[model samples]
Target: MNRNKSLFYFAAFFAMVIYGISTTIIGAILPQLIDKFRLTGYSAGTVASIMPLGITIGSIIFGPIVDRFGYKLLMFVASITVITGLYGLSSTSSVDILRISVLLIGAGNGIINGTANSLVSDISGEKKKSRLSLLHAFYGIGALGLPFMLSVFSSVVSIREVFLIISISLFLLALLLVFITFPVAKKNMGLPLSEILKLINNPLLLLFAFFLFFQSGMEGVAGTWITTLIQKTRIDNYNSALAALFFLILALTIGRFLISFLLKHFTRFRLLQVGLIIVISGAVIIFSINNYYTTITGLVLMGFGFAGGFPIILSFVGDNYQSISGTAFSLIFVIALSGSMIMNIIAGVISDTFGIQYISILIIACVFIMFFLLYNLNSKMSMK
Candidate 1:
């Protein structure tokens, strides 16, 4: 690769790492925040839910800005936002401040996810899905690594101190990003509200958007509730539940690493269909039992199954709308996050009222829904 392309790929990988940390760090830090803020269940849930809203806002807003202005300035600002949010999180004892910090971090993550995916797709050209799959592997690494790092250092440094140190490292990374050159935006890429509205009204785009909706919702449900499901079902086995969760992420990381090779042998649509089937099978397995071996096996299956969804779907979007990919991605991401937020609330209700055991039923239903959405999405893309 040329220097620019190599640098862009590095940035893309870095962006995914940032996104992974932002996504998982909340669960890692939640107990600490609760202890510091004296949070009730409702308040804690509210705090958790509010971050997605910030993500949605960022997803909606970043595309046009990137399309108009390119990625450099936006990334610089986003990194700063994340650093500020982390510092705020470390410093704050107020419930409201903690929520705001989480929100800001989510927004930064949202921007990074959209920009990096679009940026990588733009740079990779024909290899969009393959490289995106590889890029997303770093997300798994970051997600899983944070907790591991905290575990390693928790004996010496507090979580708050760790957050502060991370903030400083990100500031340095942002400076490096400032010196790297990225792909230039198309001269005519910027869209007015009228054009953006028309773009959203496209039947194909809407189909993709809705597919991502269910996709993100399914993922959100699994990641958010899997530990709880394990704990509720197993009873007094928090360590095993935590281990199961780690296995899930490890499985996902391995699956992502494999995707680079898988894409060489399989078409994106075929892989997506296979992923859905695997997810369905895993869901079925998990729905039926409470054993660690069984649960971990199902999580691993689900991990490998769900791995192909984002890269494949996004490859189509980036392929079809090269000039406006950033904006196109924004639309789908916003819709996806919205769907995830809605499903999280519904899952909360179901788990709370009918017991957490019912969450398996919810997850299974989501998998089936994703299956159909994948079918429709594949059919639509094939037609193109």
Candidate 2:
């Protein structure tokens, strides 16, 4: 039983690694895709947006399926879907096929990501925050690892070859899933309509969902635009700009591990409050400082600031809604992804019309809004 539990935890962590890789791969190889396909800015944006659409669609449906059917089938199928997508991406020449492949990857990742988090929450009991934080830390490993891998291998290997290698790895993971014994379905056959409505109408749930909204937005903007902002304000070199983005993710990854330890010493709410303060300070530094080192420092601080929100909030949701965790997670993820999409659009428009530097301003605004939401959420949670 102990061995089985360990395997379950390993599977969850492995799934998150896939999640991190699939989500970041497009960004890592976008330049190659653009060069190969001769894609225009508009076409590239359209292609990029399709992934999130796929993710949102996948997020909307995974909860009920997982709750009713259990983790094994959903995870296995999602793994296969992602593998097919990666293979398709490596082999396809047609842009139409490429888009479909991207969609598949996104959808598969959404299912895997949601299911893994829900599974951990169910298994961890009272240790959800620390466990989730550690789970997400693996995600950071994949997120940070892939680009570094690409950079190292780019000169020696073709991008298609890299995709094939990743696909092969995922195929092995899929096979491993077939042998692992997953926990049984939480709901027997179906979730009643009343339960669905109750989850939707729960004010505390909604509060947590919306708090994630701004949190996701802030993260989306920072991840998407920080490089551009760095280039516009502090550095002109592309590699240097990329390094700034790298540091942000690196800091985030490190911060998660740190938070996992720190949770033992502090309340999640107090940690969250401290994180917000750190985020505000980081945003100010980015907005006001012109030096490269200072900007990178600010990005690092922002990364650390951003690390605690999802794990902490999702743990709260998991703790409170254990019976229907899959559905609850689905709701929050869909809402959170919507926030990501909306904020990316806003940042793009603002960057185009005003200046790229305003991206920092937008991040600062979102963090403040998150802080407001977090305060209210704390009060509500306390009452509960």
Residue-level lDDT of model 1, residues 1-384, one tens digit each, is 598888888887877877776676666555455567776444545676666777888898889988888888888888888888888887876777887898998888788888888888878877887898888898888777666666556678877777776677678769978898766766454678887898889888887788778777777767766666776576545445556666777788888889878889988778878887898888888878767689889888988887877777887788888888888999989988887677767776776678766666776787677777767776776787
Poorest lDDT segment (10 consecutive residues) of candidate 1: 234-243
Q: What is candidate 1's TM-score against the reference?
A: 0.92
Question: Model-by-model lDDT, in order?
Answer: 0.77, 0.82
Clashes (N, CA, C under 3 Å) per candidate: 0, 0
Candidate No. with top lDDT = 2
Cα lDDT of candidate 2 equals 0.82
At residue 251, what lDDT does model 1 achieve? 80
Q: Candidate 2 residues 1-384, lDDT tens each?
A: 778889999999988987887877666665567678987544554566566666777788799999999889888889888888888888899999999998899888889889999999999877888999999988888777666666565578776777777788788889999999988898997789899899989989998999888887787677756655665578766556667777888888999999999999999999989998898888899888888999899989998998899999999999899999999999888888777667766776776677767778888888788888888998987887
Which ranges in model 1 have alpha carbons more than 4 Å from their true place? 31-43, 151-153, 235-240
lDDT of 2 at 317: 94
